[model samples]
Target: MNLLLMVTIFCVMKTIRGISLQKSTSHTFEMQEKRFVRSLVNQARLLSDWTEWSACNATICGIVGVQERYRNCSIAGEISVHLTICGQELHQAKPCEMPCITNQAVSLGSWNNWGSCSVSCGRGGVQTRQRDCLQILCTERFLQQRNCIGQNTCPQWSQWQEWSECSRSCGMGGVKIRERSCQVRRNTRVTQVVVNDILKRVSSPRQSSIQNVNASLCEGGDEVAEDAFPCMTSSSCRRNWSSWQPWSSCSATCGTGFSSGSRVCSGRIGSSCLGRPARYRRCYSPPCWSSWSGYTPCSISCGTGGGYRTRRRECRGTSTRVPQYMTCRGSNAERELCNTETCPVWGQWSRFDKCSKTCGSGRKMRTRTCVSGICRGRKFDVVSCNYQPCPYWSQWSSYTCCSVTCGPNGTKERTRACRHGGYRRAPFMNSCVGEWREQTNCSMHPCNVTPPSVFDTFECGVRNRRQTNNFSSSLLRIFGGQQSGPHGWPWQASWQYKNCNRCSWSHFCGATLVAPRWVIIAAHCIEESAQSMNHDNPGDLWSIVVGMHRFNEDGERYFIRRAIVHPNYIYRDVTDADIALVELRSEVPLTTEVVPVCLPQFSQPTVNETCFITGWGYTGPASSVSSRLSTTLLEAEVPIMNFTACQMLSPLYQEHLNSTNHMCAGDPVTAATDSCLGDSGGPLTCQRPDNTWYISGVTSFGFVECGTPGHVGIYTPLISFEEWVRTTIENNTYAAC
Candidate 1:
């Protein structure tokens, strides 16, 4: 029954009590109420599943937001007042947060119009503009400067010195080094000043003070003092013959024999020279004894009378032409006496000796000495004895996978067992010399921390173009790469240098856009550029081009406002800590063809995951100077390899690999499938399960050979420096318009 029926029953009972009804009627009403109550009490109540949560009520950041879900209830039986049935909860609510958003009018600072030149018009006049950032609103730049008319007085760089000879004489494992000095030029006078002051600063304290004053006047100061480029020479070379040395004396005394003479291939020392260096010719030598013939069956076998044996040898000459002059040196016959005097009677042999070993293969021996130094037969003897197997340790089992993707908290274990006769047994359990179980630390790389929400300045990890059938499948090296479709990698940014003619930009390295005004790249690129300029900052001479698919095409270009290399990075040394953050002069306009890539999360890519590398780097074995850099961006897929597996690919890698800061990846089975020259600072992007791409690594260095098999590319994993990247971008984002 429903609730209405119980109400009716209660009203009827009250009416019966108010009037002078018979006791039996009143009792009957009470009994009926009791029965209804019992029925309601025993019945069950059901509630429908909760509805989906409502959208957060709050839209602004930093405010508490709420979401609610609700359900409907249903009853199966009658209800009464006496016993109450419990009701199920029908509504729920939860707290949530809204995504962060910035107020552009407040956060974005603007530059005031350029003030008039200090003077009417002259090369020495300076024009300045103040970056009017609300100090309370922005933390970036506040002032800027520019030349009014002609270029400012700056240090002039000398012509690059001729490239030195290749470090190696053969193969491609070599480098060429060259250097240029910064010449301080004031007005029309060329002053031979050591801008870096390496000599003056080290020689005397008095000279150091003078050099410091002059260094401040130089344009961009040098950060790195040297520059090097990889070079290659042919593996094979023509043999350049050298004069032959005098022949050695004849090998033999009189008859014909052989003599050898040798010469050297002196061209390109240390390089492989084809053909033999030594030659042989016949010479005269004396006659010699060849070999003695076997002795006749021992004369007088089992004899008491004395007997003798004789053997003869033949004499040989080197040549018949010299036989008359070559006299024989040694005798051709030999003789020996045997079975002399009467032979003594042999004694009986003694019992065999005890076996040498208790188990496994061993030896035993028995001996009988001669009675009177006249015995005719053998005296001592030995024979094989023990043949049983011994207990030994079995090979260790493969180690287990690491517990964590990255961090020192992970560990792995393996085990082995003692065995006998190739099978484990009770007797062999304690015979093994080593431990039964072995454990080792693994995946000891630094862990990545989630960055602050403020750093999310742009939409990331999303690509607009759909991959086509022609898109290459796997990655590691880019040698076997395919052309990337337009806007295929929206975050791809080219680090270009303005050529001397200032007519076109030449790409030197690749970078990944992580924000509208921030990019991540290898540190060596910045160091190399600094070494070429006299000013302390090299960003002025560089441009970052985004949204461009091919060289010689137009793109959204921006100059680097400032650059910060990882603190641990050593200039010109790219083996470790090879990461840098570059801030653009202005924010890039976000579009389908221009976007940023997502930074890596705490989790790392799986070993089998196929990551991609896209760049205009050299796709052939030729050096960067050989014009092998591609004109269009190319992409290839490569799988992640564990430290052990990566290092085992090459002995050189094993010696230099650092598991904590570097990631090893590539198509180890495919030749020319790796990043090469000009590919440095490119992204090693990996796709997550959500179809978003994350910048897992930054291309640092690889094998000298463009894409030789068994040589994987080395990338900076960034886990160790992720915090630095986040802080650098957050603290130094370009605030000036």
Candidate 2:
């Protein structure tokens, strides 16, 4: 069988060699390769599982190479046929990554000195030493190690000593410990041993002999060894019992109940006591007063001294377990006063009288008698009579132009007429308020005098005439509804926000220049900003850009040095005094495109008075400021709404708005002219009789869906905070300058 196998292997080898030698076309080569692989079928059948892939062949750092793994075929009976049972290939190869080394000529340093052996005697110990790499990196390891043996005589342990007494006499928590020391065996005589000749020749030949003394006899192992075990004395083995404690309260609230008393057992754990450690006893408690019955009817009804009522209760309880008799406490009968209020003195109300007027609604007489004149309510009451329409004064017309262009002599007049529904009617005693014509003094400016230029002098409320490209001077008026001219509103400020300490600023809230170094803003804007302002360095986080209509314009920016919020302002409270002031690091230079707005001198604006609010706020209704704010500055004309009318527009306004600190501005009927998100902190400027603008209010808050009917924008009236502004400016003027 061996001879036959040899012949078959020889034939297969010869056939593989012949196919490899016959070089030919690509197709022929492929056929020959397949034949070569199949030739082994007769020699071997099924293939073994593939081995793990070998490391990359590349030895240099950062070089690409390939890896290979191989499988061997299982031997079979056939030797001449190809190995069809095996998979397509017996060898596998794949691309691999190579180790990267900084040094091109990577090599290991010389071996370091051998370290002390892990054991001082016997064998199987090792020593190690390491060297630092000379380059940034190296492929070889820094640590080198070798086997070592101890040279000194090994120490032997003596028998363990008797266990010491237990730490405690009565508790199982005590422990006992025993120790043994390494003692050298006694010798008849001491001796000096010379080093081995072979070791002496390898090292220094002049090495001296070592003396075998008691101190050097046991050097390999520790000097002592110890053992320990938990132990207890005879006293600790016997359990100790403690005196019983007081009994606990009865479990039941009343009548028969159970009470228990307990004692502690201290000694060996899990040991049983001679007697029970707990006991139970019967208890009894009586019910109190049996919950008194409801009061009886009063002896006398409706009197000055009032009436008296009495209730009766019984005491009854019995307990079989308790030896002592128990009874409920307190009196059996209870008394209380009732019906103490004074008796009704007024008689029943009389019938209502007839309608006073036949055509229009009017009140009629109604009366009732009150005995002794002592009654809880009025004696006579009256309600609506006839349901008929009445004549009333019509709404007043717009005030006509002043008789004179300027000066205190100028005056304006307005008029209203009586009306029955829509039809005009003659004034009469029944008509509401007969007087209709009204006149008020007015002044546009001193006659033949031009207001000083804002740039030449520090005159405020001045408009810039410097023309710019791609802007219309005439702007459509609507809240957040129209783009403003380049310099239409010189006092308008763009309060910018930043996401981080190093980010660029974007429109956050609108503001107005009230002074060279001060800008007024909404208190909420500080909290709503993305970046928190650090009090010590607030300028780094907050900045104001003024004189720019479009965001792309290179406007003058002033970093904030201090921000003073209104003392009464409360976050998220729309009714609160939501106003704040910002002090600039440096005073802003008055220019054609930059100027302060005049502060208001009156307590409130006249109803229906026209005013303008300017800002880069959102142009349309939005849920929040997250929507894009206007790219260019905007101004809108809104009429001053009466507090009564404004309040009736929405419940929120009714609940929060008042004439004192807050004012409303918007066309409630049209619902098309009101401030929106991002408009907060802007100005509400109304032209006074002098023809100059005055900041009547500061834009504080408005509905999320801006410009809606019955949701007028609310403002913080500067009229109410005029003194505060003046005081703050005066106090900070020196420091700010």
The clash numbers for all candidates, in the given order, read 26, 4
Superposition error at 711 for model 1 (Å):
0.8
Model 1 gets an lDDT of 0.67
lDDT of 1 by residue, 562-610 (tens): 6777878863333568888887756789898888988886567888689
Residue 88 lDDT (model 2): 36
Q: TM-score for each prediction? A: 0.37, 0.37
Off by over 4 Å in 2: 1-457, 465-480, 528-530, 572-575, 623-627, 735-737
Best by the TM-score measure: 1
* lDDT: worst 10-residue window of model 1: 78-87
Measured with C-alpha atoms, the lDDT of residue 175 in candidate 1 is 45
TM-score of model number 1: 0.37
